[model samples]
Target: MSAFNLETCARSNILALEPYRCARDDYKDDGTNILLDANENAYGPSLTTAAASSASSATTSSGPEIDFLGLHRYPDPHQRGLKRLLCNLRNTHHHTDKKITPDNLFVGVGSDEAIDSLMRCFCVPGRDRILVCPPTYGMYSVSAQVNDVGLVKIPLLPAPSFALDVANIKQALSNEPNIKLAYLCSPGNPTGAPLAKEDIRQLLEHPTWNGVVIVDEAYIDFSPEGSSLAEWVAEWPNLAIMQTSSKGFGMAGIRLGSLFASAPIARLLNSMKSPYNITSPTSALAMYAFSPDGLAVMHANREKIVAQRERLIRELPKIKGIGRLRGGIESNFLLYELLNKVGQPDNVTALAVYERLAENRGVVVRFRGKEHGCLGCLRITVGTETEVTRFLESVGETLAEVNGHDIVVYSDEEKREVEANAVIS
Candidate 1:
């Protein structure tokens, strides 16, 4: 008994920090099937091939609708075709040689793997740390903590306008030389807002900072055309831009995330990663997704989602207890606060509404009130036209019941855990 201590066995930081939980982990009630939890695409992939093949069954008479020849064999260790498409689409080419080769990119299972890999490759577990802009993405901090790497959290400036403080970040970077990775989520999770190009440039060009600046453009397609810093990575060797097929391409299940960086870093990540990380089916899907016809479907889906997001912004404010929206309407989601009769942000009221809507109404959105700068907030994904309408109606009903009523007493640890869950994957 005297020799048994879990705390002594595990690292101190690991014991102190909580593990990351996916949405499906905690909430598995019947109505929670309507999942907007993990910021997944409600609209499925640029399913041009799938559609043209058949609607009747998963398999076709000719063969399976999906490519299944190499089910027994290991998949591509280097997902070259996927990388080539991503590189071509983003136009990450050198001035002299206009071809963006597969060597310039590394594919991850999702952006989650890319994030974890960055920490692993750069930060030495107990000694080093990473910088994160909070009320942004949770995965950066979660990934750091998992690797036993410390975190320097500089939260984005508060709501209505959750902009980055470039000056503050630069100072932090200068002071914290141990910081090797800085994570910035453009069109940030829980906010749907993008960081300014000027602000990012300032951080990149900072003299004191030699660390990698990760501009996560997971939601970039929903944003303006020139907003992405992906192409600039060729010049800025220290810059690594992460984009996903999940968000804009509408293929969350495929789990193909693109990390475009300098040749050295890409090679380093490739070296560190497991051989055959991507499966054959995912590769086949990626092929169709990046093909000309598939891209058109994605473009069409993006346009529709953009329109729906705009409609949500317009209508959400009209519902009682749903106060002024907090984030920019750049991505396919809206971050807005739940209000009291007095019109201030109220977490108790917010959580109650969230719980009620999920338990009773079958509409599941993210309770972002726990996130910094998103007080009393809920992050609703931009679903199809009808789905958004259903969410709006559900919120209206739930608001009427839950508003101005605060009963449950949450422990301090419980509150922190709830807030901590605000981190997107």
Candidate 2:
């Protein structure tokens, strides 16, 4: 047997694609750790603080004491306990008459694993495709490309401020007829708009389309009440909801993502995913995070973060070059454009300001300039009170320094034309 060329063995689609670069990849440590780039909870959801400080407390006072000495063993392959806890939480908060069970849930190492596994189960390479909306989560497309799954991108409604294009989606499904999965990011990445319930209901009711609708509600905790479609999965077999503890529960380090779907879909995903993928510690932390005290902490954190988000919405426009604050008032992040001296979407300035804030001042926000309907825009994660204040000061300084460059004025026609062909790269 001859030695195989790894490159030759690699899938054709993946060979040409660039790997998804996470927030830490872009800016490692800016000394201040004012990391607003990744939509992470700057304030963590740990319940151990009370036990850590009080010297008079009993040894068992700390809730859900994790077995650190059990590192030699593997995690629970079935993850029944975690699933049951999640089921109870959903039943309580989702306000649905129907009950969700452990059988209806599938756990993964972040929603990325769930997304990838679903593609593996549903899509056929080269023959089948997935429908995606532009300026949504990068991972959906990246995962599709890696899985050699085709993409039918339907741009979001422009005039309505980046709402889901339900009309075009139906049209795409009609034409393609091979789209197996539809990835809808509610509280959409880079565009904090929550998907309209009626619009999603229409998609679920699309008579001709037989594909599953995977609604990524990773940021739904920050969204309004009744915004999430997780509960609807019980009624609609084809609807799958991807939720995460990373954003609201502050369990990013634990790497636990959830998929709430019909029992069959959940089973299929569980069957296809790697055995023992989630570790013991991660499972323990997640289970504890959903416990009574932990849930209380999560709610407290949401209130404070939402307050800061409102403060930013009220104050960020006061900065000189920030043109228009886009996206709905939802999620832990905001997307707003950076303008030039003559009042144009200045991609150059946005990029420069992002770099300046990250490299020089230790403040980091994402430059979403090239995303659809997000021209000359930056996506900033809502941080704690002190972090938000520091961000305002540093970002204001950077914008002031970068605002005076010669700008290219685009005609409305040209703007429309260029923006129409929105590319993720």
Candidate 3:
């Protein structure tokens, strides 16, 4: 049991905010014919069968046909059905004894919305701050800036592991009472390393700090089983776990993200959010994604992604100018450095290759060279087998062209030796 008080931590204004009410609040639109409460285009959505077909196939789910006509009316602001389905999915997949309920969940446009909402709900603009572990997600910082919340920086413990500095984080929390939120990205964005549960527990159980500890498990599905701290939310009132259908479920287009927290925290977020934050179409698509067939498909696709990730790990270091693979293999992406002539990580070569891959080779990858501890690094998302093959060939060619020399292929033993001695720059 935690002694954290929501009213004490949340902004005074937010605590007193009277949420906006809409027509749906007064009258429920239970798919009745005489639905004239909310002013909507009664004629129905101007979408062709082709469009509906495209949408249905988007998630590869064979669920019920979408109600195109329902586009005229307002969507369920509460998203009760969606939340219930999500709860079931997590309860089964994560195999937790303490079952999750709708009251413990809040669905937003994306993880970005939940991130921004948490900042708005708890931290007062310009007065309060949120702590972030960099080489993690950029949105935490971006959302803080957008919300006018100050930031307390604590970069992850170097490369390879990219573990959280629990000691420094605790020290910062004790030093800064104004820090209302601490954002920890598990299987981090560019780092791809999951923060240890014990380190997170240290902050959660800190005797002094009462602020919320938000663990962003955006890529948890890609990591080993039982890695999520979602189950702990039941016990820790000051803890919130953010997950998404975007990554593993392949439903990014639906823009569905979930925040699992104490019932009080979840209710606060729901009260402050816009009435129809989620569109009808988005909800329809997401429902399909939560269906039994959808879950199977998602798991199958995840297996494919994991397989490709392993392939990249085994093969990427063999490339001539590519340095050692940085970060843990816990996400769909891989971060590796581009080496200069003397086998040193070089940002110049990384940027050049990034541009060439998109422009000349038609293979796009993100250049994360500017991020801390990620100099000369390119973040490559695992793609289809064919796509991976093309990328390997194209990147090798691009490196050779940039270096103005033929690529030096290495044997298994030589590759190991080179990787072992490669300098992290």
Candidate 4:
């Protein structure tokens, strides 16, 4: 089968439209001059940070009374320094100590912005279409629809696991000639299932899906194997890996997201993105977070979260309704089923329990009901051990209360049946 060419499947507006360019910065090089082009503070790293870095632990001051600097100027739009640090960090652990180049790195307001940029760059509103797996992140769909692009849905195979259907995706791509982009959420949001590495590699290798595959690896940090695609950005031009600092970094408030792709694609995405989208303070904070110490701390936290998640999965089943807790191969979130009337577990009916937990216990967990192929299940984020313990305690109380209510309702129905029989007699 012939693949869709630019002339065949390109969005009309995008093909015809002239590229938009923002005003050029006078100071664009990676240098240390007055540093005024992007309005960054001429000041360097914070004095407190310098002091802390150099001082011994015993001599360093504690608490929040630390002196900081460089709050008054605009941050680097390119985020070159931070990217260099991150590249080295990613290389040391994930790669063979080869730095991730600036061309392959793009830091945006958040992963949300990277998604939006991808949509804008590829989807020709009213012309081209995007393909997504069901029960995945909603942002892929939302961003496509917002851009006036059409969407094609290919749902995952159901439990005891929610695995990707590579055949179905291939079929969909062939069936629909208009698809310009394919969005995948690994360690999926609601399902917490990671797409199989082979499946991802297959999608990349397949001629039909070779255009653009946005792997939303937002929670990849918590996944068991870590990220496999970020290092392959240079090898695959059509590949754009979307990641966020919010999750493992515990800096969601900073709103820093990154896109890894070829330099040309990176430049195109940058063109599509809003100038000054990320604030100075945010860029500063993100740079700080990317520091070796900051990242090491995040890695420790991720390890802690993974441990806590395992504990939840093991301990949750002591409750009657929560028969057995299961999870995807990679992500930290867990989705467990409730015991149905036959004492057999029913995976599709946990929404009621989810609501009950939220209402009665003031606990909030994702209820994947009719929407995301989460038949009957509750999606709980992995929290700290203390938090998870508290959450499980609430789960126990909430389940008992729910079971009691169900028994009462069942009894009332039986009583009504008896009353009807008496009237008939």
Best by lDDT: 3
What number of clashing residue pairs does each candidate have, in the order they appear? Answer: 3, 0, 0, 8
lDDT (Cα, tens digit) per residue for candidate 3, span 181-205: 9999998999888888888888888
Encode model 4's per-residue lDDT on 162-192: one tens digit a residue: 6788999878876786677888887777767
**lDDT, residue 27, model 2:** 55
For model 2, residues 1-425, the per-residue Cα lDDT tens digits are 11212233223344444444445545554345665665534443333544333421432342333212123333456788899898777774453678788889889999999889778777768878899998889999899999899999998887226888888898887778578889999888878888887788788787777678889999998887666777677877888899999998988998999999988677666666666778877987788888898889999999999999988876666566766777776789888788777768789989998999999999889999898878889889999999999998888777777875332333467545444432211
Q: Best by TM-score, which number?
A: 3
Model 4, backbone clash pairs (residues 3+ apart or across chains), number? 8
What's the lDDT of the predicted structure labeled candidate 3? 0.85
* Whole-model alpha-carbon lDDT for candidate 4: 0.68
Is 1 or 2 the stronger prediction by TM-score? 2
Candidate 1 lDDT at 295 equals 88
Taking the tens digit of each residue's C-alpha lDDT, what string does model 1 give over 1-425? Answer: 01212333223443344434345545642433665655534443335555634631444353333323334334556666678788778773422234446777989899889998877777778988888888988888888889999989888987766889887898898897578888999888877878887788788787766578898999998887756677777766778889898999999998988898877678777776776678878988988999999989999999999888877765665565666677688888888788775767789888988899889988888888878888888888899999988888888778777754342323466545544433221
Error of 4 at 106 (Å): 1.8
Better of 3 and 4 by lDDT: 3
TM-score per candidate, chains pooled: 0.78, 0.79, 0.91, 0.79
Candidate order by TM-score, highest to lowest?
3, 4, 2, 1
The lowest-lDDT stretch of 10 consecutive residues in candidate 4 is 62-71
